[model samples]
Structures are given as structure tokens and as C-alpha cells.
Target: MNLLEAEKFPFQQTRFTRTSDIQTIIKLFSQFSKEELMKKNQEVSIAGRMTGKRMFFADLTDQSETIQLKFSSENKKFAELDNGDIIGVVRGIVCRTDTQEKKNERKLSVEVEEFSLLSKCLRPIPSSYYGLSDTEERFRNRPLDFIVNKQKKEIFFLRHQVIKNIRQFLEEKKFIEIETPILVSEASGAQAKPFITHHNKLHRDFYLRIATEIPLKKLLVGGFEKIYEIGRIFRNEGIDARHNPEFTTIEVYQAYENAEYMMNLTEELFHYLAEKVFEKEKFTFNSHNISLQKPFRRLSMIEAIKEHINIDFAKINGLEEACQLAQKFNLKLEKFQKTVGHVILAFFEKFVEKNLIQPTFIYDYPVEVSPLAKSKPENEEIADRFELYIGGLEFANGYSELNDPTEQKKRFEEQSKQKELGNEEIASFDKEFLEALEYGMPPAGGLGIGIDRLIMLLTGQNSIKEVIAFPQLKNKEKNFE
Candidate 1:
């Protein structure tokens, strides 16, 4: 039947006075003896969707638990009810049944006195006996997937708990949650191409934020000592098992702290999440076990490259020498990737990143790649930046934020030069951000963590899409035929 016809059907809309959930009822049944149950004979009511049916017996399930319902063959209303139908049973008595083949096994059931069909299932649901096997179909029809697989539903619940724990952890540390704009004239945050849109009323173009870094740091300059924003960031980038074009991030900034402080904070937060949320100090992701115990391994970017590739970047002096070494390794370089720092970063990405299976912090990044990070005091080429890698994925990026206006302007100029050299990922100089820095900002540290990746790691999910409820997918063109 059509939807309108189904709506017109005389389905009961009365409220059910359910005494307990299926689990609670089962617990109570186990507590009371069979003779005591019969003596008390307390009437119960419950409502849920019909999940299974076999002749006169049916299984009804709320999202939490499932209970059995037995119907008399003579009841016409019971005959009309089918699997996948919304049902409400009233004045039911708890009972136990034993099969002749399995006399030792007793099953709990509810003998129904009256029942109502709240909604009709006109279409047949996919067989729960067989399961939803197609991955694409499962993603497309997520609600049906949830119905068929309880584990899938629980993953989302776990995701919610993880986020809640993160919020609580940050709040306990006295970090203020703040919001920043999603659209702006310049997307000067991270090194990624932005999704641009025209603002009709203003008659100008605005880019969706690729990162929350710039604005949050500006708030730091505005005298908010500890601030954080958990928001969605958009980037026009390639999609992979780990990367999404649009994803959620938690960016935090604290004044009077350096990269070391952020690192320690990150370690503490992860340990807290593992203990409080998962109730463990370690968890396995994609067959690789990871520990959240204190003191994650720390390695400088150059040191990691040296360990993995056996090429000491510290000894390499000039751009020509770096390019020759990269060429010898057969690493591909873009047009703008000619500098020594760029080559070092390329080597790290190609040789070092995937091998970092344990929780490790690779710090001291090239200054050219980290425009907003402060340079190391002794060495001008390396920035006080670090990236947290676990399960062969980069989960977090943080740095000692650069507050020097003169040096910041010079760095922006260098980024502009790179943009002119055909690097689309290089951010344009944000005048407003520079002006804010000119107003005398404090020494600070900033960190950005990809929420989706973290969730995937903690939940043991292999892909970012698995953690995200509605991830971006390619458009399916309809076939007229």
C-alpha cells in the first residue's frame, strides 16, 4: 500500500504504560521463582518493533533489548501483525517455556492478553537471518544497517561518549569553548585548498574555513588565555581511508605555554579517554595494538627521517644537496617544492610517516612548512612543531605559536611567493590576522586534532567514514532506462 493508505489505516495511537524494558523484565524474571511469578502474576505492557516471527511466536525489540511475545492462533489482530511492524502489547504475563528437544533450556516469554498494531510494514525488511552483506548498500541505507546490526549502532554511541569525555577533559582543564566563523575572505589557517563560494549580497567571494587556527589564535591576541573550538573544517582535498574533504576538528590555544605544554596536555587527554571511556590503558586498531601509557615516544623530524631513510638531514646543508638526495631516493617533488625544508618534509612524508605505528611525537618541523610556528631559538630552519602519529596515521598537529609580527609578515610573504609558484595549498596572507599579531599577543601554544580520526582509532574502525554518520560520497546518476 502507498504511504497515504497506510497512514489512513486504523492503527492505535494510544500510549503504552510499559513497566520495564525487556532487559529489566528478564532480570526480574530471573530473580523471582516460577511459583512466585505465578503467585504475583503482575501484568506488564511494552512497545517495540517486531523483529522476528515464527508461527504464533514473535520477537519485539526496542533499541536496547528484545523480548518474546506469544499470540493465540484464534486472535485476528495477532494474525495481522507481521515482522518489522510497530507493536504494543498490553496486560501481558511473564512465562517460561521449554522445548521438547531442549528441555534443560528455558526461554523467557510474555503471554499477551491484548496487543495493537501501531504501524504496518508494507515492505519486507532485509532478512535478519542472512545479514546486510553489501558495504555500499549498508552505507547508503544506514538506518536499516542499524536495525540489522546492533554493533553498528553501538559504535555511534561509543563515538558520542568519546566526544563527551573530551569535552569534560578540556572543561576540567579550564579551557573555554569558543566559536569562530566558518566563512571568511581569506582561509589563512592550514596548508590546504579551500572550497570557495560567492557571497551574493556582498558581491564578493568567500572561502569556507580549511582550519580554525588563525581565528582561534586571533582570540589569543584578544586576551582569551585558554580557548578552544570544536567545529567542522572544509578542505578541497583528495579523500582516502583517513582524509575527508570536510571533517570535524578540535583546535585549542593557550597563552604563556609552549609546544611542550601542548604535548603533555595531549598525552594526558588521550590517557584519560582510554581509561575513562574505554576502561583500558591500551586498545587495538586494525590488528595493531596501541598503548596509552605515559610518555609517548618523541623524535625530531630530522631524527625520524635519519632513522627510517638513513639520510641525515642535519648534515645536508644547501637546497641543491637536499634536492639531489631526494632525487636519489626517487621522491616526487612539485614545482614549488625546491627548497631544502620542502625536500626534508617530502622525505619524511614518503619514508617516515607510515612506519610510525606506535604513539610517537615527531617534532622540530621545517620552518618553511610551518609558517605559523615559532622557529627554534638555536636553529632558524626548524620550527617548534610536532605531529602525533598513531596506527600509521597523523592524529594531531601542534606547535609553539609564532607571535612575532615582523617574522610572521616575512613568513606570509614567503607563502605568497610559493603561491605564485603554483602551490595551491599555500595560504594567502591574512591581513587581519597579521594586524591582530601586531597588537602584542602573548607567547602561546596551539593544537588541532582531527576528531574523526581519533574516533576511528579509539573505536578500532579502519576508515574515517565509518566513524562519521554521513560522510561525503560521490553522486549517483540516475539511469533513465
Candidate 2:
């Protein structure tokens, strides 16, 4: 930024040293009485941006904390100080003060005996109250947003702690972390459109991974009993409150475990995070008070439909009848959704999904929509898959993985047909993943949670953009000089 009034204040400090920060000073001397501090007379060096009103008393803030600074207005250097100036307080005495301006309240502070202007804040730091009302403005300029709205720091702090505890929880269970490739020949694993890029070296097109599931599953096939990946996933899709083109997900797999076992694991993970990171079972998200303390409610897809809409879907025998039911509910069916299974899912999403405000697992997803999941032994039409929903958004998906190569091939063919029928988001027929399954991978369960959405829920953020620091925005030319 260009310096405003440059000729007035020249030669800002190139480097300055400090012995203590505001937080350390407060921690060390806040307990002592006024007489005790006067007797001890601790001298320290500190530096931070000058925040708040500046007369004799000013608040100097660093990342750790903010502390008061008292200076003489008569001192020419202090007299010329501006709010937002980066300055160092040299040989400052830790002291206590009482003032009528503070309603006779005693406050711990520091007396600024000597000072130095470390840097002249070239651009005026945006006003804390009036200047940052636009949401887009705040997002486009995150650094200024952090300075103006200090409370925003807590969101990221929670984000860090949440991810840290996730590693801790999974490590305690002996789950190894493996980073998979970002660019791949096939963006298979979950059904989503991929961001395609050409590889000049290989002379073939590659897609950014839409999910970490395929490679992590390969690790499982190569005989890692338990493994997980916290990874960035790219999808060629629209951006909205819950959807980002690039997002994060944690996909975990365990050998010799089934969908039911994974369901239990998902619940335990959430409960552990609630008690461990947040230290509470209740959280407010999207205007709902969700509790992780209770056992999560579980229901089959058809059961969930019945519970919410009083419609028993199991009795709907054929596509014609299902189509009629969709018509009755005013739900439009796309060309690829011309099956009983697809129509059942359509009905569930339209009628039941939003009603799952608290933690609820709706299982027995249609095999048409869940190609990687094993089919229930008794019901080949239904996959042994479940999705955990909270605050009307799907937080986690888990299933008993399909290990039979032949069945997996059939499912891939089904998905290819769906893609031909105008469904852009369908799993690819990954040749390598199929080859891995042919080696007889043990029957296993896999679970995936969108880390961004989970953080949004835990932190009470309504939009995905709030949790992410640099969310993508529409193209606009910079007109700045």
C-alpha cells in the first residue's frame, strides 16, 4: 500500500526487538497489587499495533492479547502517534491504574516510558464498526477482516483444534494416514463431476480427485487394516451455502468391518469430538440445537420416508407406480431417474432429508445411487449404506464396501448407463480399482465426512464460505491503481 502523507513520517523502522508480548506481561503481572507492582518495577519491551482511542491511554494488541499503554501527549513522538501505527514500547513499566472514565475500575496496564514507530500503517485499517458491513468485502480482504473483527479468529482456532483432535482420535485407534494423489486418470470413488486437466508429460487428460476413497481403498486392499485420508476434493459444480467447488473430506476405511460397524464408529467419532474439542454435547447450527449426547437415530430409507411423510415406499412395486407417486408429491424426475430405486431416493431427499435436524442415520440407500457399497444379502436392490445427517445437511456417508469384482463391474456398467442418460455425476468404471478388488480384498466398511461442513456445524456457521478462509468468488477485474 502507498504511504499516505509519506513526507510527514519517513524512515519507518526496518527492525525492532522486543523482550515480552502483551499476553506474557498480563499473565506475569496482572495478579500483583498496585503497590506491589510499583515496588517491583518490572521493565519490559513490547510491540504491537496501536488499537482503540489514543490520547494518553491506548490499547496495544498482538495476536496473544491486548494490553493498555500510557504515554505523555507532550512527548513529540507520542504526540504524533496515530491509531493503527505499529510501534514498540521500550523500557515500559508494568503498572496498575484507576480512572473515573472506567467507573473507578482498576485495570492492569503498562507505562510507555520510551517508544519507537516500527512501521507506519500505510493504508488506513478499516474502521471496526462501520466499514466492514459487506460480507463479500470481508471475504475478499481477509487480513483486514481479521484486524477489524477480532472475534473471527476464534472460528479458525476451533477449526485447527477440531482437525488436531481428529488426528488424535484416529491415531489412538491405530488408523494410519496416507496422502493420495490429487491428479488421477479416473476421479472415481464418489459420484461427482471432476475438474479435468491435461498432463503434458503423460499426453493424457487427468482429473482432480473428486474423493480420496479409491486410493485409500487400494491401501486397504494392500493390507492396511485401518486407514484414513483428510484431503482436498475438487468437483465441477455450483457454489452455494453448503457446496464449494473445492472442499475437504475425511474418508476412513477399516478391514473386516461392515456397514453396521461403521455406523457405530461414525457415532463414536462425533461423540468424541463433541466431548474432546468442544467440551459439550450440544451445538447450535442452522437454527437447530443439535445434541450429540444421545444415541443417533437410525432408520432405513423406506422407514424414514414413512416416519416423515406417512408413505410406505416398500409397497411401491414398479417404476410406473413410483413415477405416479413422484407426480403426486410434485417431484420432477429427470430422465436418468426412471427407476424405482432412483424414485425412492428422490422421494427421500425431497420429503425426509430436511427433517433430519438432529443426528440421524438413514440407511438402506438404493443400489442405483451407491455403486461402491455392497448390496444387502437379503435385498439385492438395496445397498448396505448409510448417511449421517444433522442440521438438514448430510455430514457423513458410510457403507460395507463391495469386494466382488463381478458385482462391482455390473454396478459400474449401471453407472455408465446412467451417465449416458444425462447424469453427469456418476462413478467411473475404474480399471485399477476393479483389478485391486480381484485380488480379494477383505470385506470392509468405509466412512466419509465433509470436514468443512462438520466444522461449519460445530462452529454454528450457516455458510461453508465462513469456515473457509479463501473461498472462490466470481471473476472481477481489479481496477485498483
Query: Which candidate number has the best TM-score?
Result: 2
Shift of residue 363 alpha carbon in model 1, Å: 0.5
Q: How accurate is candidate 2 locally (lDDT)?
A: 0.88
Q: Residue by residue across 1-481, what tens digits does model 2's lDDT show?
A: 2345543343555677899878888889988998999999999899988876556888888887888888766766675667788888877999988875777577898888998777776677766556566788888888778777776767888999999999999999999899999999898998899999998888999999999998988888898989999999999988889999999999999999999999999999999999999899999999999998869999999999998898898887788888998999999998998988899999898988999998999999999888999999999999999999999999999999999999999989988999999999986889999999899899999999999999999899998988888887765576432
Off by over 4 Å in 1: 1-19, 23-36, 40-42, 99-102, 478-481
Instruction: List candidate 2 stretches off by more than 4 Å.
Output: 1-18, 129-131, 476-481
The pairs that clash in candidate 1 are: none
Q: Please give, for residues 118-199, the per-residue lDDT of candidate 1 as tens digits.
A: 7787767776777788877777788788777777778888988988999999999899999999998898889999999999
Instruction: Give all TM-scores, in the order shown.
Output: 0.92, 0.93
lDDT (0 to 1) per candidate: 0.86, 0.88
Give the candidate number with the greatest lDDT: 2
